[model samples]
Target chain A: MLRVVKPRNARSKRALDAREPKEIEDARIAIFVKGTHTGEVVNNVMKDLMALKRPDAISFSKKNVIHPFDESSPTSGSSSIQSLEFWSAKNDASLFAIGQSTKKRPNGLTFVRMYDGKVLDMVEVGIENFVSMNDIKSAKSTPGHKPLMHFASELFDTHPRFIQLKSMLMSFFNGEEVESICLAGIEHVISVSCAPTPVTLNTASTSADTATSLPKVYIRAYTTKLLSSGTRIPRVELVNMGPSIDLVLRRHRDPDSEMLKQAMRRPKLKKTDVEKGLGKKRKNFEVDEMGDLRGRVHVGKQDLDKLQTRKMKGLKGGAFDGETEEERPTKRIKTS
Target chain B: MDVSSILASHNAKYQLVTVEKETPIEVDAGFLTVTDANSIDEDTFNSNIEEHLQSLARDGVQTLLAKLFSLPTLPSSDGPLAQLPPPTTQLPRSKPLPKIKPLTKWEQFAKAKGIQKKRKDKKVWDEEGQEWVNRWGKDGKNKQVEVQWATEIKLHAAEDHDPRKAARDARKARVVKNEKQRFANTAWAQRAVEAREQRKTEIQRTLAQSRLSTASMGNFDKKLEGEKKLRGIKRKFEPTERSVEQEAKASLALLSRMESDSKKMRKNPTSEKSVLNVRKAVRFASKGEGGVALGRKTAGEKSKKGGKK
Candidate 1:
């Protein structure tokens, strides 16, 4: 059993921030930005936003995500299409990005094309739809009833200024890079869905144009239930189907300095290969063994020519080896 | 309504059954949670049945008690009775409740503002003066004076590491290294020197030998009779190219000496006693022979001449 509490008075809050209403046919002004931001620019923009919202309503919450990867979507299979139809019954918001192409969806969602600065895009996905839709009776968490959805595991880091943050994209995108938030619309389709919940606007000086024409929506999508042990975890995540800024931050994890200290290592070469690389130039030597030293030794050209007169080295037996005329050796460094 | 067919299929999820040899048994866990269906294992089945029977037994006992007393039996463990403490007895009444004091506007505002004084002194006048002054003075303009005064702490200057001794050591090093460098050039220098001396002496010796030999051959008079060519144009003894090349070797030797001395003195000036001694001698000579502004002892005559040189 769930107890539904009536929303409290937030007139004091709505005066703070109000986005352009999806139901409105026109907007007072639509500001578009070209690129993402650097830290300084984000800081300045956040300061401007804070200044603009100082007088009226705003939302404040602190939460720690323990299991951020737990999420699901409907695009993985057709089994969950019925559940999506049921979802349309309760939630009038336009959440469906693609379809089987019915009168309801001829061209699918043109969400990316319609983005402007004033029209903010954000994504939130969670667990619940996978288990059951409490408002509906026939639906239940079963394998064939509502399937898992797989969204890309890419980064979602934008509007760091708005949230007082710095996304990982800061390394690639300069202050001038185009920025986009994955805008999964949780929108209304008149008879098929209900009005989307508007947040408590931050306290700021808001105009009547905001109150009459805008909606402050928290765009989110959720899974039907947790996966059974029999199910294999997808190579891609089946639960988180939309852009998650927080998840992007979680993926950008860093190791501590202790890890770097652990990495202090030395490079070593194998001693066994040194000799193989050096071959027989390293052969050892012996003393002289030839009959005469002058036969193999070299002198100046003139001296060699006049060797007979110079009497440089006599062809004496074993002269190089210090042997007497008795011993004669072959194959030595010298010649007779 | 004979809905057994429908119920049977729904119960398939929660059911525990022995399959016939001919067929496979597939029961979906979602349709039959362990909570509602018979446990697949004997231990769970016995435990769950035991727990359920115990609650029913307790209910039956309470119902009988209710009939006898004409009042509601103690609610079964299945209800609120399960949450209540053991029937030892109810707690007895004690002291009366105290009143919560409502704070005055002055107290509430002071609490909310979160002001902390240097000490917890309770002076009304002091609070009034300090609180009012601070509240009115919170605009950005008043913070400037405090910020300006706070920013007076200056950074200290960095210590300088003097490399003068290193330079001197490098200079002394050049002298020592020059000796090795000179050794390297010696081989080529010796060869060049030998070649030149041999060529020079051979020219003079060969001419003398040729004249003496001619006399012995009895052709000296004939050979020297009128040969002005030999006297006028004996291949003029221009220094050989090898000698010029040797000059390079010598210069290289000198350069390396200077380089070594410069290197040694640069590496360690004070540690090099020789360089220090030489520097001292040079400074002494410069001081003495460059002429003293003050009167000095005169062992310096030689130094003055060397200084001039």
Candidate 2:
């Protein structure tokens, strides 16, 4: 799971390094997709979870805080809170986002923040009214469904669904574990008592074809503006960040090409950059008889004498001379 | 010029060359000078020389007497009291006498008191032992056993000095020895014993804990795949007539299904649904759209196309 921290200085524009910031040391969150889910659903959820990597939103020292899925198993054997804690301890993750699918709620995504393997707070975001790639007959037929169908929303504040999703996600920080809220189609929408707004996004009845509803549900998670106070509550807030859909799901003829393009987005260390100033020849290194570092000119008389003897032997052995003449005449000469 | 003059010039040149070179200082005085001076003049030299026989005989007899006198006193020499004449005259020895001596009186006294002077007083009082002891070497044979300062340990004669002693000593040193070797008091001894008992109990407790931990681990004696417990080899091959009939029925059903599928395919070689399905599949397979009718068709169009054909 990609965990991002807020940058400390807003104006500083230096490129990020590989090392994770110490500030985010205690804020790492492990993401797990339930092993029981189908491969396609798990893959989709994982892509969405990784999309939450917004190092710019958080003061993270690392350019990429999220380790790739290949680093650890995406599907854990057990989804129990205790087992999750064990996994978190093993991965050194302070928080965990578990994705589980059930008969009632097929696309359930839960975000939980922890401290020393103890659950500090938790929020469950139900993915609804979103069109999966499977629902569209042919991606090549329509261009509008390409970006809309796949979750790649760069504009969070302007997008209405994004705003609602962010507010709902931030509501989890008001207190500890909250009761699972029930909506028309959603079986649960977790929220604390002191939430900024009501858990139900809309008071009106949800339409039958909620899939075509305005402001689609994009499930992107990110660190939010934490409330700074004298109280004892957790200071960090994990807000729903941005675009929670696979980048390649919009590809027409081939999804693999899109995946490759997405994979290549990572910042690489160019060979030219690495070998820029290493063109000059280095001076010959020498060590003294006492094992101290000294220039070649500082070699003592004894060492010089030994070297001279070796040089003389080398000269006598025809080391410096060209290849020696053959000792024996060839059989052809004997026949002649 | 004569040949001698040429040789003289050559000799002169050789001398000059030798002088120029750095010849060793000691070599000339060591070997060359003696040989050059002793070269005999054979032209004017006396060949026969016989003189002073009487004086030579007397010098020889005097040297023989001196040698006999220098001989060690032998047990059987008492019978030979061969009297020798004293020297006719005393020979004076060479000396560069000192004007005055710088020898101290103390040095003179130390030199006068030799080992013979010390040996004169054999029986002296040993202050530390509070007894009179004969300080002579021979007197040691009669000295008391403990009083003897240089006593040999006789380690080689001891029974423990066998070849196995080294290995046994090593093992003994490694064994958990008594901690009370320092203080023999009862309180310290009790404390040492208690410490040993405590260590023993700690080791036993750790062993027990390890065993219990192993016991608490999951027991994985699961059944192997396709395993039939206690079934003999004979039972594995026991052919039942029922499975044969079941196999024949299954094969017959598969054959009938294949025949029906082939017949239906032959009848609907150009069905409208199949054409539409093929069209939809091809449209899905097509690359990025360029005014192509990709997947937006309906059953009406398919039927119309079929009618036209």
Candidate 3:
């Protein structure tokens, strides 16, 4: 249960108001938690991740024993979930990363996404390889700068698991939304690609059989360099910025369909969107390929006899008079 | 055979059973993905980019849908649902590995001595009870002396000395010593980290100073490979495009903040006492005799020169 906080003054009231849900939501805040026994690898991973998520990230120095996925006992897991919910409400954070390492599963990191102060889903992965920024010896993107994400696998769009992972990563790295951004503001790119699937696996294998045969995912960060080009758009080059990591997927819990639907619910479109023809379609009017709104008009058949036409001196008497005017060539015979 | 050709033409018209491409699409049904590795047609791409992109997207989606349909599905309330297999791509860890902790004194010594730690069982054998019991808790062997009905004493022990009390005190002392050692270990690690940070700052300061030691302020110095340029503090100011009304409001708010900050600073009891500055008066008076001399004069001790006069 979340403790209710009543603001005592205007300043406190204003601070509370900042955390209230809005039509356009504020950037997500993430809380990095340390487990009861985080080894060196997990600890460093959390630190680096916190660095990337700075300004919107809060880290707990104390170790917490949270069994988020303990299926053996419902009570134990729910207790951990309650603690996470409590933290979420207190800190106004919806995303969390818990780093826990043990003898059985060493160097493990879990990402927990919360919806309405409840755990939505969790994905745990093991750190197979890591290269910190210090080793790269290159310029790093300014802190708080939004990174451009590139997912190079088609599975990200088609597979449920990959789709969830993609969305999680998108929200994790996304900063404040802006209507427009300067080209120079794009400083870095984070590319996530999958290793090619092995040839031995049969294409007709069931989902359960293929679950354990997934390929490794590689995450690479690169600083973008925009150089002058002959055209208006610049030629861009990617320079390797460190913290390159290889991770192996371990365990994941999918959200219920009802809960997922609730989580994905969006606010009503703003007036500006409706004005720009982005809202629901109207009868007989459509936005064409060029984004221009086009409308169809229906009119009754017209009477040609009653239709008004432009008056002309040449056709004053009709076709017979115009022919007589052309046949009167004797006036020009003397000049010839 | 004639009927088969007509059926084939009808099937092609109704359903896009096949997509013709110079390079065949690669499908990974397990992941439900399709990769069209074929190069773009330059003529079509240049002539109409939208049409070309739409065609490419169409092919890709068709291939993906074909692969998705081939997968096994289970009947559900919503319809026949195709389950997605777990993602195979291994992603990079979001963070770097944690730094190793500084070894404690005991650990350092053990490492140097090549001592391997052996695991000890929590339960110990009790000779009298002929059963295994906890070594520490719940009728543990460690508390045997304190819980015993009778205990032996040394021959030279004091008359008032209770063996149980002595044993309990000894156990408590051991716990306190262990706790103190633990504190010392943490303190040592903290000091090591602080010292390292201090050293780093000191080195940076010295380097900064030495760089400015040259006549040209090290601007003309020989550059080293992969050396980073010195960076100065970056200055930021409010946008100049703001309206005058907004600018005035902002300035007023800043002024109020400054006024409040000064008021808070002056809230100290000593500073709030009086307007008269006693330190300034002391400096002004006594012909520059200083505060100590003035205090002596007030205490009825005459100066040497005053006494001579």
Candidate 4:
């Protein structure tokens, strides 16, 4: 017999089922920059994006791309979803940074991250505060240091969603399902398969004597959902977890500081393999180890003398050379 | 409509018809082919006659028009008198038309003689009175007279004294005579003497070094040179960029010293002292009035200078 099913009342709270943490899928983040900005602005923003230096991050194309954010525009592929799926399958990059610019904010750069064909997080950084490289040069910023975009992480620490976004990137980097906000100063203190990791100070306890210890590094986990607040479409946001750690890692450096100077120093260029193999001495009439005559030709003394005494003009075995010419006495007549 | 009918309807209506009339004329004046005389009614022809006559009468040309137009005569007592009889009254032809006689005998005599009357003189003599009287008695003076008198009182000169000047003189005298004032004034002299001695010693040391360059001499000069190198005081005046904090400290010190000196002397703060106080207060405020924690100073300065690496 079919039993009658009762409707669950909205007032009654449902129990949360204990399920395993969602596994993080390892994928390269494809950076797609689309804007009407000049080459310099685009390049500066790309530098900032690349400065993240996550192992799985790669630009979707070469710098200065003008991809359309509007999916309906022609040449946006047959369908946006199909194109994204195709690119993701081909590049193994389900994550993407869609940088866009609009008329409302001309000097603004917006970075939209997509995970599995859906938008995960977005960050809009305005470039109004950025000083030009020429200005930095004129101001005598330390030698060997080229003024580059350095994001001030402290400015975003107050923002509630920054950490969540940071953790999302981190999870993509490590490819592990982070259940809790487990973090330590530049050290991996927990794993997804392990039992609840015990928290410990990696360097030293927080005290006056240990003030010189390395600063703490933060790890956060994010869960995104469409938070409806009366609009027809809901705003996608990461759920906020209250303040956990006071670790303010110096994410941005002074554009003119000594550390930046060292970072901007170019690697010393050494001679190439071919130049090294060819020694300083001029190899005349000598063959290289590969049996190739790679140097100037040597001239012998006898050859030099013969070439010096060689006659420029005068017929050989002629009247001038003691051989008499035979006389042609009779005129030849035409034969029929 | 057909084309011929349309054209006939729009064509000018001109039909030549001969008129037979017996009149007292050798030949009849032929009318033009486009004459509008027959088309005009008798009422239309005479419509403007009355209006023209009324207009001519309104312009005082009615009699002249009556003769010209040969209009029917009317009775003298009717709408208008006939043009055959002219109006009766004529303007007087007398050389001197009747006019009011001049009131004065002289004016009357002037008119009788036909000589143009002289305009009444602005100034007229009173013949009855032997003396000539002014036409108007004492017309108000045209220009104003500004009368001034010397009323300054000559008083004896009083003693002149300014308290600030007196104080300055007293201070000068004290500095010249009083021991404390002498001591304060002597400070500059002492500084000058010390500076001269130092400069003399420096010159002597340099001279000795120059002389010793020829041969081995005093070893003490070597120690002096080493001390100078260690101190890094090569010149009396050396310019160094002062940090904000150090400048504030120096200003505060100068103001405090000025404050102490004025207090010890029991004098009111002068303009210079007040100016110094303002400067000191500003510096104190910039130093945060001890509200900023000691540890945060470096951090705040670094942030202001563009955040740390």
TM-score of chain B of each: 0.15, 0.13, 0.54, 0.14
Give the count of colliding residue pairs in each prediction.
68, 10, 15, 0
Off by over 4 Å in 1: A1-108, A113-149, A152-336, B1-309
Can you tell me the DockQ of model 3?
Answer: 0.01
Which residue runs does candidate 4 get wrong by more than 4 Å? A1-38, A62-71, A74-82, A117-124, A131-336, B1-309
Model 4, position B289: C-alpha lDDT score: 48
For each candidate in the order shown, give its overall lDDT on alpha carbons: 0.27, 0.35, 0.69, 0.35
Q: Give per-residue CA lDDT, model 2, range B182-301, as digits (tens).
A: 233446556767898999989876754544455433234344687434322474543455687787987898889877866564775674553356545664665444225444445568
Best by lDDT: 3
Per-model TM-score versus the true fold = 0.13, 0.19, 0.46, 0.20
Error of 3 at A74 (Å): 9.9
lDDT of 2 at A138: 30
* RMSD (Å) of each candidate, 1 decimal: 38.5, 58.1, 34.2, 62.9
Chain A of candidate 2 compared with the true chain A, TM-score: 0.30
lDDT of 3 at B32: 32
Q: What's the i-RMS of each model?
A: 28.7, 64.1, 16.6, 61.0
TM-score of chain A of each: 0.14, 0.30, 0.81, 0.32
Q: TM-score (chain B) for model 3? A: 0.54
